[model samples]
Each structure stands twice: as C-alpha cells, then as structure tokens.
Target chain A: MATTSIARPQAGVRPEGGGLLHRLFGRQPAGYLFLLPWLVGFLGLTLGPALASLYLSFTDYNLLESPNWVGAANYVRIATADPRFVAAMRVTLLYVVLSVPLKLVFALLVAMAFNRGLKGLPLYRAIFYLPSLLGSSVAIAVLWRQLFAGDGLVNMALWQLFGIEGPSWISNPRYSLYTLVILSVWQFGSPMIIFLAGLRQIPVDMYEAANLDGASKMRQFFKITLPLLTPVIFFNAVIQTIDAFKAFTPAFIISDGQGGPVNSTLFYTLYLYQEGFGFFRMGYASALAWILVVIIGAFTAFSFLSARYWVHYDE
Target chain B: MTSSAAAIPAIHQPAERRALWRSILIHALLIGASILMLYPLLWMLSGSVRPQDEIFGSSSLLPSSISFDGFVRGWSGLQVSFGKFFLNSLIIAVLATIGNVVGCSITAFAFARLDFRGRNFWFALMLGTLMLPYHVTLIPQYILFLQIGWVNTFLPLIVPKYLATDAFFIFLMVQFFRGIPRELDEAAMMDGCSPWRIYWKIMLPLSLPVLATAAIFSFIWTWDDFFGPLIYLNDINTYTIQLGLRSFVDSTGQSDWSGLFAMSTLSLIPVFLFFLFFQRLLIEGIATTGLKR
Candidate 1:
C-alpha cells in the first residue's frame, strides 16, 4: 500500500484522477446518490435495529412486554449459571474444530484428484459438486435422519455385511455429533470447485519441471502445488469457519428443532434461535447474537494475523 | 446407467503382465470411493417410496413395493398446501432473481463505467457490508418490518431485494462490467445515448451470460432460505416450502417418512429440470465467471 502510493503519485497518476476534484471528495450530491438505498437501509433499518439490539441485550426484553434493564445479569447468568449455554458452547466448538478441518482436507484431496488428467473430467466435476447443490436442501436433512435411523438402511446393510447392529445415529448422543461432521464433509464440493479453479491457474510447467527432476507426484504437490494454493486455501478456511459457526439448518432439522437428545448437537445458533424466537427472550437472544459477532470478529482478526505465517498471496 | 459398469469392483482390464495388478488396484480404489459417495443419495430416493412401517425394516437397495401415498400425503397434508408453499417460494425466488440481475447490473455498471461522485466511498461501504455478519442486523430488520406492519406479507422478502440488500451480487456484476472494454460505453454515449440508455443498450445485452448466473444463484438462494421466510411470515397460509417442511415435522406425531422423501424428490424436479434446461448457460456462466475472476 505504501510503495504503490509513492510510485503512482510520483508518476502523476492520482488515484482519484486529474482535475475532476468536485466529484472526487464527495463534495457533490452524486456520492450520496449512489448510496441512497443502502444509506436508507443502514440508518433506518440496520443502524436503528443495531443500536436497539445492543440496548436490548442489557435488559430482559421478552417480545410481549417492555424490557427491564437487568444490567449485567443476563451475561452473568449465561456465563456461570446457564448449563445449556455451556453445553451449547462445548458442542459448537467441537463441531467447528472437527468439521472445518475435515472439510478442508477432503476438499483439497478431491480437488487434486480432479486436477489431474482424468476422463470425462467435467462430468466428474459436476457429479462431485452435486452435494453442495443439495447441501441445504430440506430433503437432504430429512434423508440424513432416516439413513441413520435405528433400523434404517445403514443398520440393515451392516447386518448383512458384518452382522453388526447400528445405533440410531441421529438420536444417540454419541453418534449425532459424528453425523453432523460427516454431513458437513459431504458438502465439501464448493471448496473443491474453488481449489480446482485455483489449481488450473498454476502453470503446468511447474509440475513438468518438478517431474523431470525425478520428483515424485507427492513431492511435486507438497513443494510446488501447496505453496501456490495457500492463498485460496486460506480464503476457503476463513469462509468455511464463519459458515461452520452459523450452521443451523441441518442440525436444527436433524435434531427436530429441539437441539436435544442430550443437547449433543445443540449448536450455538440453535440455542440462540430457540431463546430469541421460541422462548421470546428477544433481549437475551440479542446478547447471544452480539457475543457471536464478537467471537466471529475475533476469530477473523486472528486468522488475518495468522495468515502472515502461511498465506502466500503473489502480491 | 451407462456409468454403472465403470463403478463395478473386483474386475479390471489387464495391462502388460507385470503392471496388470497395479492397474486393477487403482481402479478398485476409485470405484469403491465413488460407490460410497453415491449410495446415500440412491438410498434416499428408494426410501422415499418405501411403504410406511416397512421403510426401515427393508435391507435392499430397491423398495419391496412402491407407493405414491407418501408423495400424496406430503403434498396434501401440510398446514399450508404444498402447492401454495411452492408458489410462495417461486414468487420470492423469481422476484429476488429479477431484482438481482436487473438492479445489480445497473448499479455495477454505474460504479465501473460512469464518472460518478462519492463512488469510491460508497463502493467501499458496499464491499464492507459483505463482511458484516448478517445476524447482527437480522433482529433489527425484523423489528423494522414489525413496526411497519409488513411482517406477514411477501413485501419484507421482495421489497428490500429491489433495494439491493445483497452486496455480493452487486460486486459480482461489478467485476464483470470492469472486464468489458470501456470503448462500447464511449461509443454509445457519442451516439447521443443517455447513460441509462447506454447501460440498457450496451452493458445489459453484453452481460447476458453473467445476468443468467446471477438470476440462477438468486433463485437457488431464495428457494433454500428458510430463515428469511420463517421470520417474516407468521401465518401458516404464507409459508414457503422450507417453512412448511419444518412445520410438517413439528405438527406430526409419527413422521410420514415416505411422504417426506417423496416431496423432497418431487421438489428436486423443478430445480433439476431448471438445471437440465439451462445447464449450458449455467456451466458457461460458472466457468467463465470463475476464469474471469
């Protein structure tokens, strides 16, 4: 950022350009014109609500009645006394750690396989990508429920092959969490597609040179491919982490919206949702929502800081 | 169907005698992985038609007997008619798509091409919004709608879309517009075309491929969004398909598994058919959009 400014301005190429300065500083109305819609929404909708929500967080505002400010009571209650919040935080943290890493690994592996010279590659790409298309589908969630049922196909097949019995994966606290993780891994298609596109950008000459030097495929991938793919991988990592935190629908549906069977799959958003919407603890829910925002913001900042170590953007 | 042969295991074409086993080994691994991935979806389809009480008891890939009752029940049994639910989804999705393609393209063109004031600051603000976690604003937006008495109507869903609630679409369109040569806009303006006319005549037509991509993504997004509809619409009569699906589970004691799966399969029909019909456009759009980026 610093180098570009010195070089470009010295070359007499202003970032704002020459002699149309009225428009440049937003001195004129045109600046406001382009932002009219969003400005209205931000001020009238986003800002007002945002402030109200922050205020509401300090109070006990159920939807039906006026809020009574409880100072830091809600926070104290949630942090120390609320067992559900602890359970939810534990489940949510485990889910994020397991699913995000697994999905990234699977995505990279599938992307590498597709990047090679394969027959009917586009067809392969499309088929592999179909899971992402079906990712949030209500049908897929419903299907997942039955597939892991006590006497469902999974167990029936298990009986035939190994004569083993299967537990109700969705209902059993032990297995429900695994089911969510696997479901997340199934939707690894988007990151895979992104990786495939990123892979294609890497010049084939790099690989050819590596191969001719008696490097094995594995060595070429680690040395040449991994370094070049770092930026794309980091981008996917951040996006997937944020997404993992917000993952609600699948867990909601599979758990039958109760987040139950011993609160094993009681994801953070689910509890926040139940509190805010189901119980009408609107104020408490808002506090929960803002805490999430803070957590997400902190993680995003941490990832950006951590990127200097691993992320290799060409610029 | 034709690809099933390739998925079969334990058999492989021989290479030179020494390398034959290695070739077979690779094929075996590849085929095994493909089947493991594909089996769940195939089972889901089969389970959807399996008769009640027998859905779980069966061990076979194919159902012992098929019944359309599940589809019938799923379609007819909801608090809101599934037809109305589908229509509600269709309306929101179509309107959202139209707003995205038309509105975002025009805005993107203005930002990329026109010598507009405050453009950079406003553009920066637009980009910054993309980073804002949506839930931070979700409650307030709900309150705003509730105060305005627009909660139950589709207005909450459709109106803001036209007002450009989504910045991703706008940014995507901006990238495409920036890639186009500036000469066309200049030529159109030289021919005495107004800026809006230039946008319509030159940019819009040239951006059809991207417009299609924006439209299709908007459709898919709005169709799948349960949260938006669930928040805005209180009355059961106004429920979208996703809302109906969730409520169906809530309202029932014993879930009609076959019916649920049947509806799911049938619902896929529209999206599947849409993709089948526009696959050429979809892929070309996706591939080029990714490449140009």
Candidate 2:
C-alpha cells in the first residue's frame, strides 16, 4: 500500500560518484534484469502492436494482401459513410449509459445490505459473486439466450404470474439490448465487493457520533458514508465504464455471432470483430479499435477531471 | 442482583423481542435474495438432468423424470469429445497461470523493492497500458503472430503471459509486495543475501496470497476466454471449452439445446469447485486490489 516510500529506499544512501556509464548500469542491474520479461512484452506485444494499429488505421490491409497506405480514408469513411459504424456507436453508448449506472446502483445497494452484518455473510457474498465469475463465459451467454427465448423460462414466468405473453427477448430488436443490460447488472458482484471493502474502511466512531448527535440513519449515510465512499464509487465508475464499452461475448453469443436481429445488440467490439475477422477488413477494424481507445480515454479523463469536485481522499 | 434484574426485565423484554424480530427479517430478506440470485444456475442444473423434450416445455425447478441422456450426448461433442476440449483448456490455463505467477511476481518485486533510474516513469507507462483497450493491440498482434507462424496455435495466448502482458496482476502483486516490511529484505541483505536470493527465499514465500490470487484469476480467465481462441484458432482441434460450447449451436438456426446445457454445466463445475474451496482467497484478492489503492 505504501509503494512510494518503498520505491525510494536508495534515497537514504548516496551512491559513490562514478562515470556516467557506471552510474547508469551499476546501481541496479538486477532490477532491470528482473524486469526483462515485462520490458520485452511491453515493446513487442503491447507498444509495438499498439503503434502498428495506429499505422494500420490509415491503410487498406486484409489478411490476404499486404497493407496498402490509404492515408485517413478509413477514418473519413467511418465519420461520413459508415451507417453501421454509427449504429454500433449508438448501441454501445446506449449500453454504457444504461448499464454502468444501473450496475453501480445495484452493486451499492447490495453491498450496503451485506455490510449490515447479517449471519452467514460470507456464504451470501460468495453466492452473490458466483454470477460475475461465470458471467463472461460463453456457456452463461448461451444460458441467457435460452432463458430469454420466446418459449423460455422468463416468458413462462410472465405467463404464469401476469397472464401476459412475453416476446422473445433475444430476438426482438427493441428489448434485446435491455436484456444485455439486465445481464450486466446481474453481474454486479465485483463492484459490490469493492463497495463492501470501502464500507468496512469507514470508521465506526463516525456513525456512532452521528447517531448520538440525533442524526438519522439516512442522514448519516448521506452525510458521512456516501462522501467517504466517493473514491470507491469513482474507481468503479471508470473501470465499469471501460468494461461496458468493451463488452462483446454476451452480445456476440446472444446474436449468434452476427450481432443480429437487425443489429440490435451490435456492440462496438463485436462489430470490430466482424469487420476484422469476418470481413477481413483489418485496417477498418484497426481504425475502429483506435476510436474505441479514444472514446474510453476521453471518458476516463473526464471522470478524473470531475473527480476532484466530489472524491474525498484522506490527507 | 436478582431483585434488580427482575425489576428491569419488563423494560428490556420488548426491546429484546424487537431485536429478535429484526434479525429474523434480515435473514428472511437475505435468503430470498440468495434464491433469486441462484435461480438461473439452479435452472441450468435441473435442465441438464431433465429429458430433452421437457427442457423448454416445463418451468419447474425439478424434472418430472430425470435422465442422463444430455450428459452422455454432450460429452460426445460435435466433432471431438468434450473431454478433449476440457483437457485443452486445462493445459492452456495451467501454463498461463504459471507464467503469470512467475513473470508478474519477478516484475512486481523489482517495482516494489528496487530503486532505479526512471522507475516511476516506467511504472506509470505500465499502468497506462492497463487503460489502453485490448482491441487497440488486437490486429497488429494477430499479424505479428501470423507472420511468425504462431497463428492457429496456443502460443499466441500463452507467450504473452510468460512475458507478463497482464499488467493488472503485476499491479496487484506490487501492492502486496510493498505491504511487506522492508526490514525483512534489509536483514537478508545484512546476512549477505543477494537480491535474487532475497526474491527467491523471502519475497516469494511472503507473497503467496497475492500470487495465488493472480494464478487463480489467470486460470479462470484463460479457461473462459472465447475471443482470443476464436480469432487465433481456426481449427476445431485447437478449440478451448468456450469455443467447443460455441459449436453446439449452429449460428444459422438449430442447436442441441439439451446437450449444450449439459456441457455448459460441466464446464462450470471446475470454476465452481475452485471457488468453493478457495472462496476466501478469491474474495481477499478482489477486496485488497480495490481497497489498497
């Protein structure tokens, strides 16, 4: 936790004065040696590919052919002519907007309940967390499709309880994305765990003091708990937003890998996959990939910029 | 003492009763929510045991007549047996987990214990990669692997792990490593231990919880990964459990619904069992990662 201090241990002892080469290499050769694997990966796997994608964004590369330089044509096309790109953006944004807030709210509420110290709390927490662990699996996505099928369990429940026949939640365009949002919210365990940790970190004396001073439970939560938990909330917000933007498997599986039923669940990542692998439009997919990075970066930057106003970090 | 207690009994009795009622309400609510949360999983289990016709025909939690046909057919898989896919997944997951544990811990130790030129700068760069979307690196990495003839093999998935491509685990381990008191390392150094010896004998042994956390996550993620294998592996023989499951449904129309459910249940068993045994470590891993920062 106290990383900054640990990293500055050598500051306490001055190195003997030496030539430039000695000073550079002699002080910590083993440190760099230990870091060799990550350094190689950072260059070859991450940075190299990342930069190559930027170059590929302006090209016309298919797997079958050598990449031909196009110089901004891909970006121009996405900006102007690509209706599916716009649809994908719209769908993805709608998803991020709908799912992130809903998921965080559910996570916070459930976390608060669990923080109440009910008996068998560990069992409850583990059971609640089971979904998030399995949520991304193709198996679960397949199960989700079956559950929301026209004659599936969900529809059966609707018929039995409300005498209303439910539409095929996966097939219908209007409600298809909503089903994915529900799925996202259902897997709120990760954030709920974080929130529980944050709740535990809040000093108990603050609550007791507030209670003694005639503060109601609701007032205490608003005045003390919520403010103290803002940092955790902010962290979850950024991570979940990025995660929602990158969401693919559920939509891909639910739509049977086509992003189908008239592109209702065509998440941006799924569309990028289709463009890259399915259509062999590698350059276009690369461009789409950069756009996703930019969009996520912007969202993250905005959250951080806004965080100073609300996030209360202890001094 | 008896006289005073008897005099106050009437006053405290109602309060004690109210507390009992409150506890009962809380337990009742929690139990209800737990059932709702677990319903989908239960349904899948029941569906896997039920006959094919009754899967979608009935909404009941229990089957009227339980059958093992789904399990038998599902294990036979579409082209290869499901056992092969499970083995494939296990091999890849285990290798990746070992790679992550070894590589990430080494990297994290350097970050946590050593002071070097541009250390903070390098650390910042590593954290920056965490925020960079994976899609940004997807195409070029594919092309790189394709050029090296690593495509359609497990190398693409397994190699990066050996290089500690997952910065999240490194960050987690670094935090855990930093929490270990510097006195231990200093004392080892005083006893003429080299950095390597300190890392091997002291740091690694002390950092087991974080390492376990990283290993477990690495295994589960690799085992469940679909997009990575789907893009890289064109051959059915190289399919992981996820890719195998995907093959159960024909994208155009038909699916072996019962068989799919049965196999899906089977696929989840490993993860479920792991979680059941190591729930404490898993929860601690997540909690520590989130709260430490």
User: Which candidate's DockQ is highest?
Assistant: 2
Candidate 1 deviant stretches above 4 angstroms: A1-35, B1-27, B253-255, B278-293
Q: CA shift at A34, candidate 2, in angstroms?
A: 1.3
The CAPRI-style docking tier of model 2 reads medium
lDDT string for model 2 (A85-185, tens) is 98899999999999999989988988888786777898889988999988889889988988999988899988988999999989999999999999998
Q: What is the per-candidate TM-score for chain B?
A: 0.86, 0.92
Worst 10 residues of 1 chain A by lDDT: A4-13
- Model 1 CAPRI quality: acceptable
lDDT of 1 by residue, A1-315 (tens): 232233322222223444565435432233344446656655665666778888888999887788999998888888889899999999999999999899989888877766766555666566666676666767677777777878776888898899998888889998898898998888776777778778888999988888789899789888989999998888888888888888888888889888978999999998988998889898888888888888998999999999999988874
Candidate 2 lDDT by residue in tens digits, B1-293: 56687769788899799989988987888789889888988898898888888876577789989898988988885778888889888888999899999989999998998766777888999999887889999999998899999988899989899899999989988988999999998766655566788899999999888888888888888888999999998887888899888887653133566777899999998888878988888787778685211
Give the distance in Å from residue B281's predicted Cα in candidate 1 to where it truly belongs. Answer: 5.5
Q: Compute each candidate's TM-score over C-alphas.
A: 0.88, 0.94
What ranges in model 2 sit over 4 Å off?
A1-21, B1-19, B251-255, B291-293
Name the lDDT value of residue A227 in candidate 2.
96
How does residue B117 of candidate 2 score in lDDT?
A: 70
